[model samples]
Target: MSHPAAELIARSNRLGSDARNTNYAGGNTSAAGTETDPVTGQDVELLWVKGSGGDLGTLRQEGLAVLRLDRMRALVDVYPGVEREDEMVEAFDYCLHGKGGAAPSIDTAMHGLVDAAHVDHLHPDSGIALATAADGAALTRECFGDRVVWVPWRRPGFQLGLDIAEIKQQNPQAIGCVLGGHGITAWGATSAECEENSLMIIRTAEQFIAARTAELEAQGTHPFGPIRDEYAALPEAERRAKAAALAPVIRGLASTDAPQLGHFTDSEVVLDFLAREKLAPLAELGTSCPDHFLRTKVKPLVVDLPADAPVEEVVARLTELHQAYREDYAAYYERHATPDSPALRGADPAIVLVPGVGMFSFGRTKQTARVAGEFYINAINVMRGAEAISTYTPIEESEKFRIEYWALEEAKLQRMPRPKPLATRVALVTGGASGIGKATAERLAAEGACVVVADLDLGKAQAVAEELGGADVAIGVQTDVTSEAQVQEAIAAAALAFGGVDLVVNNAGLSLSKSLLETTVKDWDLQHEVMARGSFLVAREAARVMIAQGLGGDIIYISSKNSVFAGPNNIAYSATKADQAHQVRLLAAELGEHGIRVNGINPDGVVRGSGIFAGGWGAQRAKVYGVDESELGQYYAGRTLLKKEVLPEHVAAAVFALTGPDLVQTTGLHVPVDSGVAAAFLR
Candidate 1:
């Protein structure tokens, strides 16, 4: 790349793409290069730095903050002392080359004040493990032998940047240094050399941690303490089964302030950490790196109970633990808050740990939740290394609280875009691969709900899910709703993928238009089994999840007009529809106390884009109505009060309307989306 900004981006992506180098949006890179001044036509030095909140792994030109090196470095002349360092961030805007590029971050000063042409600030877990050690400064001296210096713990700001600059000037041979209780920063004469230095720091830290761990193991004094037999991970199937059961309960508890989407992990890193005897005390001390703290909160909610205990006992204990966690979090806020500090944003732990189960992380979106989990894994790595090398010692709680409640961070949070109507909600749609089910999946995904498209056709279901937005926003699960086990599996899949089910759409069905004389016993059983029994199975399983969540929920049944209207030659299908209609009433009355709203949509002959119609059911219905198959939709439209065909999208819209913010109080009510069919209207 000819431009300095492009070069910085290339360098940043190379460094940030690897988890060992840095995590998502957790590092900053800058390049000091010459660029011609637009107004003066003279060569001037410029600083191209990774901006605040931009992920270096996927960074673009717009994600870099371009600053006039002369102007940015000049801020030090009048540098307010460490007490007034936050004011320096605002000063950075005045040093910008133009009113473009991403906003400068807190580390801008660290990069600009340094004399090197290339600089990188990163939070590699291995590097941070050494940084948070009790003897970090002495350890840094021993590790690099003066080749890399150590900067003692200081909250990152302009002053910290100045301190690094002074250290660099004094030590000409140093390639980089570990920021005590923070991360690492490296500098070089060129971009390649800077990247090499960054990688060397990371690799060296990893090697040191590994060798030290082995040494400790040889001495029979490993960092995490002996593996507790009682805390050993359960079998994979049993562990995940327990996770699925506990997900809803954890999600509901975490959603006390605002509803949160969740992500679960049983990776070896997590399982190993949880299986150790020292897990509780180490977790309570909290993570060291600022990046880890931001995503994972100050500490986690550790489930201090037996992993193999009965589900009921475990659940009851979780409730007590959850209450204690909230109270402690509120106390932390109260102790640290100034009059101007933002109100306590939340009282829930973003990370939750269960011995023998794994980790659960919650956030406003799937990406956030998943990233939070990833960061906690990084934290585990950090804690392990710190314990192996020296006693793990994080920054003081006061310093952590100050940074956590920093006004600048609050402003960033406030600036985030408003969430969509169904944000943080997860939905499972049966038969979601096509027809009204497919339409509902798309609509819910568009409204910001994580969707699970469950259908018998796995390929089509996966395709629909991909179209909605892959694994992050949606996923596909092959399910035969008629089978109780399959229905349970589908619900479990949704719980595993995105915490718990907040809404479920029972739209999987097949119609058989046969006269009583023509319909055989086999045909009758199949229709009732797929439609009536299937809906019951799905509802029952989803209700278990919903009740466990204690967050209340929505279960919508796509019952048909045939449920109330007597359509000819439709015996089994019509009877199944009637069964579904009454189920809404029964479930609504029963589940109302749990805050679950059961509703139904009666759409009259949604022939266009419907799986039921495409699979030859339309031809049979057309023969009975005495109309050609091609004109069946028109025929159905003509019978309605309003001469408009009822398409699958109309039914999809009814499902959203019932579950969305607008109809929170409406339940056991069937909304007709058949373009005003008078005969099918509820009486």
Candidate 2:
């Protein structure tokens, strides 16, 4: 058996080598991003794209061009057909080059043609193999079916774009298209999805090619002779060290995620392939799939020298290749692009596969890198199988352009709007020292609502405020929401600190474990004073502030699930919480005319390593359940569908959702943040 890591390393090598094969120097893979398309310009607030001559592996924000989205879409309807290509190309060139040295990719027209939020186009061994095969189109169609569309081989450039335009009109949902003798193109609502789709296609194709090749081997003598072992021929130390150096990079790229990373090349099949003079043809076919383009590009890097090449030297060569690749991308943009107005959706490849070294995926965030990495691993296996066949096929350049630039495809590119649901709104949360109150305070902070955390426990409140990250945005105030004087002082302080209050969360409460019959009147009075009466006092002050500010605000009450479902105990706590929930609905009804939104969160056991719960709740609950503290934790964990403890974060998320834009039309709703504890209550 072959180690998957070695196999991945070898296959990745082939993919990178293949990319360099097209223009041995490197290929252009960026977009001209200047000018001002009327449609894309109006639609998007900011469309950042990579600059020409910059490698995606080490790309930065400065390397990108920012553009509006709406302005570009408007051009699609007015501009159609082959003659428009030059105008489009010129438009891209004007904006991209006008900004000085930035260049666009050869595939700029394609990105301009798609409506995808993000797009990726690359030529890989699998794509090329399929493209060059006599039955490549049929094979791709048979394997991918409706998941992808196949285009007859055509020379890259303008006319191919027209063909893709026609095809995309027929299949609106086609993620990408395959060109008979070219590479692949994929698109999605976001870069993550696009990268995933590309890699998925490669994985699917690898399976198909492997199945077919195995059947052929059973029927006749294998075209490629028996496999051999080269890694075994090396010293044990060399093999171990190679595996050690390659694992993290491979793991990062996911070309092959073996248990120990060193297992990739342990397979006999992988060793034989790497030991070959030239990767011998196995059958007649293409590369893995179309999507591997963004990860592996169209080719792999090949080193004819010793296995122990200097790391620095190898890296330098890779760097030069990337630089040349950038130049090629720029030249391509110069020839094929017009106005650099629209944001380039799929011009540059996001990741690069270096044959002997490893794979590198570029992204601004870790998520972006991981998504690209996963695709590269899938591409490696698919490329191996494609090598056994003929060569990989790349999608026609024109078709790739259409998908990359389609308006509908680009619509998916918009990011989820930021969580500033209540812009310029101010909030004050009481009992914000720990648990639900603290959760609610943080939630409002995230929603772009300035918050003041008020609590009797000043230290805890201050700590929570500091963790929220901005002194300008949040503050900790000491006050008893139940005390009229203290409530007034806190409200006054908040007004001075953040101008005026726009939202108030009445979340202070006391929990008593006494049974209903055994409970003292003192317990009842204490609970009501803090939970129910305190809410009324705080709300009164908040309401006065709102009326004075002339901008009505929201009031959210953090109640308890015990208010709805009864246990044998918890009489006083239940009564007060019940009042809090009712108060929110009543307040919402009365405050509607003032433009205020009132809501409540009823949560249970918002456990965390905080002062309140860590004090005794865990221990007491454990004793009640006849289990140790750890066992009690496990009991709660098993009760939820997600099989996780109810953290303060979970409750905070609920509060955020309520205060967020998704609930603009919603008010007076009680969101249960108990991880299905309510469901359990119903059952």
**Best model per TM-score:** 1
Worst 10 residues of 1 by lDDT: 1-10
Residue-wise lDDT of candidate 2 within 1-683, one digit each (tens)?
Answer: 44322222232233334432221212222222234446455322323444443444444445444433344434555555654454554455443322433344434545545555555555544555555555677777887888778888654445565566677778887877776655676666644466566666656665666676787688763434443333123454454344334333322222211111111232333444444434323211212333444333333333233446655464455445545555554554455444632454333334443333233343322233434444444444444544456444334443444444433233434533443565556678887878767777777777666678999988888898888764656779999877998997787666544445667877776666667786899979988998899998998888866654445567878786776867546678788888998898898888888777888887766556434456665666566557777676577777666667777667767777776667777788888766667453522
Q: How do all models score by TM-score? A: 0.98, 0.39
Record all residue pairs in model 1 with backbone atoms less than 3 Å apart, i.e. clashing: none
> In model 2, which runs have C-alpha deviations exceeding 4 angstroms?
1-419, 639-643, 678-683
List all candidate RMSDs to the true structure: 1.4, 22.1
lDDT of 2 at 484: 97
- Per-candidate Cα lDDT values, in order, are 0.92, 0.56
Prediction 2 TM-score vs. true: 0.39
**Which runs of model 1 end up more than 4 angstroms from their true locations?**
none
